[model samples]
Target: MMTTIVDLMVFIIGASIGSFLNVLIDRLPKEENINGRSHCDHCGK
Candidate 1:
C-alpha cells in the first residue's frame, strides 16, 4: 500500500514537470511572455 502511494505521487510530479516543459518549448519560439497570465490567442482577453 505504501509503495503504491509513493509511485502515484512520483507519477503526478513527473507529469506536471513534463507539462510545464512542454509549454515552455511551445511558447519560447514564438517570443511569448511566460510570466504573465495565460489567455486564449483568438480572443486576446
Candidate 2:
C-alpha cells in the first residue's frame, strides 16, 4: 500500500541521517574540523 511505501521511505531516510550523525559523533571529538579519522578517546594522539 501507499502508506506502507511512505513508511518505508521515511524509515530509510531517517536511518541514513542517523548514520551520518553517527559518523560525525565518532569523528568530531577526534577533530576540530569536518574531516578527520576517528580515534579512541583515551589517547590524545
Candidate 3:
C-alpha cells in the first residue's frame, strides 16, 4: 500500500513536469520574449 501511494505521487509529479515542459516547447518557437505573457493562439490576445 505504501509503495502504491509512492508510485502515484511519482507519476503525478512526472506528469506535472512534463506538462510544464510541453508548454515551453510549444511557446519558444514563435516567441520573441520568453518572459512575456502567454495567450491563446486562436484568440490572439
Per-candidate local distance difference test: 0.89, 0.80, 0.83
Model 1: per-residue Cα lDDT at residue 13 = 100
Candidate 3: residue pairs that collide: none
Number of clashing residue pairs, candidate 3: 0
Model 2: residues >4 Å from true position, as ranges?
A: 32-45
| TM agreement with the true structure for every prediction | 0.77, 0.69, 0.72
Error of 1 at 21 (Å): 0.9
Backbone atom clashes (below 3 Å) for every candidate: 0, 0, 0
Question: Can you list the residue pairs that collide in candidate 2?
Answer: none
Give the runs in model 1 whose Cα sits over 4 Å from its true position.
none
| Candidate of highest TM-score | 1
Best by lDDT: 1
Which is better, 1 or 2, measured by TM-score? 1
Better of 2 and 3 by TM-score: 3
Q: 1-45 in candidate 1: lDDT tens per residue?
A: 999999999999999999889889978998998777777878978
Ranking by lDDT: 1, 3, 2
Error of 2 at 43 (Å): 14
